[model samples]
Target: MPTVLVIEDEPGMAAYLKTELQFEDYSVLLAYDGLEGLQVYEDNAQVDVILLDWMLPKMDGLGVLRRIRQTDDVPIIMMTARDYVSDKVAGLDYGADDYITKPFKMEELLARIRVVLRRGHERATYQVNDIQLDTKAHSAVKNGTFIQLSQREYTLLLTLIKNVNQVVSRDELLDQVWGTDYTGGTNILDVYIRHLREKIDDDDSDVIQTVRGIGYTMRTAGNDN
Candidate 1:
């Protein structure tokens, strides 16, 4: 799972960011002040991106950026009210990867997050046997034939493909795809698995096989695992 560390001192904005990022299936860590933010970053070794406010207590965002740049190259995005061109230039020169002004639309922020992610990370494509996915574009294909997939279907396929030959338990799928607080029954998972099968399975056999009592596994041709 990808993680986002949000450092905004404003109670309202920080809560909003945490909620929206979590809704998008991202693991989110929140810090209300610059010092706390630095502590949070140091505690979590796998922070993918940071959304930081310009003015913060204990220390400023640029200070935090400089501190982090001394060792790590992780992407940092400034989300603040400093819209002056000089301010943006200074932030970028000081090692902030991206800058977004305050009162920003959530969609724009999300898109910016994705763009930085694509640049900071490796290629987004994942290929397993016949199935292939370009995660950056949110597109998937089977043997070069485009296969239409819903958001849920794409996530489900990506999870299984990442695990490849291993069994993904029912609890795991439910937690990752449907969120941890899902109140629905396991039948929902079966339903989506059927939907995926219809789109990607070969005519002769199922690409994703049941693991009997354990969970489910995706096995391509010849492997038989």
Candidate 2:
């Protein structure tokens, strides 16, 4: 199940968010303070998204954002009563994917979350080399043959497929696929790419190309090849 991390100092607001997110069939993690929020993220790196508050006790939301940015790039939606344009700009500059104002409608927040997640999953499949990824179905197929993928493999594949012909940087893939909550620093992306190549490209042709000093890109096979 998809998990959400809610970091809000206000008890009532936090509870409301938790309850609402749960209603959406998402596993919700609640943090009463920024410090606790960071701890929850550290303990559970698989969190799909985060709802952060601007102000909090035991470290502020921006600080938490900075710390998380140093490692994980999980999508964050900041909520604040301060409606200043400057505040929104600051949050975006600090790496927040989206921001929400206080007293907002639950439907709006849920809509934003859906858009972000959908975009993330959309990148998991591509049409290059006669392969298509149906993200909603969480499956990939080549020439009508279904490809089975582990959860992480599916996410990583989607990231590459989404950027089919573009050079997707490691950091970008990490932030979007691994999420901002991931703290691991190994060559996990490389492993997944190799796995994908083996299953999707190795026997036929190399669809995923590694641009030296840049990132990976997928190319469709030409008739000559």
Candidate 3:
């Protein structure tokens, strides 16, 4: 059975979610605050998904998300009352797999959770040439050497590698890697791409190619010809 960790502060809401998840035959773990939620996540290795609330007593959802992304890439669905696009983007950019607004239908939430879980099972790791990424382990290895990456860098590289040889647009990259709510200029993508190149491509062999106004494409050595 898939284990779900619900990190919500409200007693009523938490109870409601627990009951519904139980009805669906999902094993549910409940935590009323962000701190407790984090602790629960650390202690329990079986947690497959997390339904995180944006507002909490001890720590907010974003803080919790950041901390978790430091080590785990488990599918997270962020629940928030804030409906603004900016808020959604912030959650996505912070590494949330999905976002749900408050006052949502339980059925819809369940459906989204199913989709995220399915996707997680479908693509746990990706490999091209000598580069490898283990999404479950949240680690990247290149030529038998572990590549140390910041959270954003890891997310960025994963997105690129998923698409492989296809040209991933700047807008798409921003939306997927930085979140669509990103208000800053697109130069940030360039910066991160440069960082990835420096780390992943030691010989300056153009593993990641800039497509001028379009975006970028990740090319493996085997596909370069």
Off by over 4 Å in 3: 121-225
Query: After superposition, which runs of candidate 2 have C-alpha atoms over 4 Å from their true positions?
Result: 121-225
Predicted model with the maximum lDDT: 3
Evaluation by TM-score, superior candidate among 1 and 2: 2
State the weakest 10-residue window (summed lDDT) of model 3.
Answer: 173-182
TM-score top scorer? 3
lDDT of 1 by residue, 1-225 (tens): 789999999999889999999999989999998889977976776788899898999888988887665445678899878688987988899989999998999999999999988888444677888889875455789888999887678778988987888899999988777655569888999999999999998788778989988889987668884
Report the lDDT of model 2 for residue 111: 96
Write the candidate numbers in order of decreasing lDDT.
Answer: 3, 1, 2
CA-only RMSD, every prediction: 12.4, 6.9, 8.5
Q: What lDDT does candidate 1 reach at residue 59? A: 83
Q: Give lDDT for model 3.
A: 0.88
Itemize residue pairs with steric clashes in candidate 1.
none
Query: Candidate 3 residues 107-217, lDDT tens each?
Result: 999999999989884447788778999878667999999999876788789888989989999999887765545699989999999999999986757788888889999
Tens digits of per-residue lDDT, candidate 2, 52-79, equal 9999998788988987765456788899
So what's the TM-score on candidate 1?
0.54
Model 2 Cα displacement at 101 (Å)? 0.2
Looking at candidate 1, the ten consecutive residues that score lowest on lDDT are 66-75
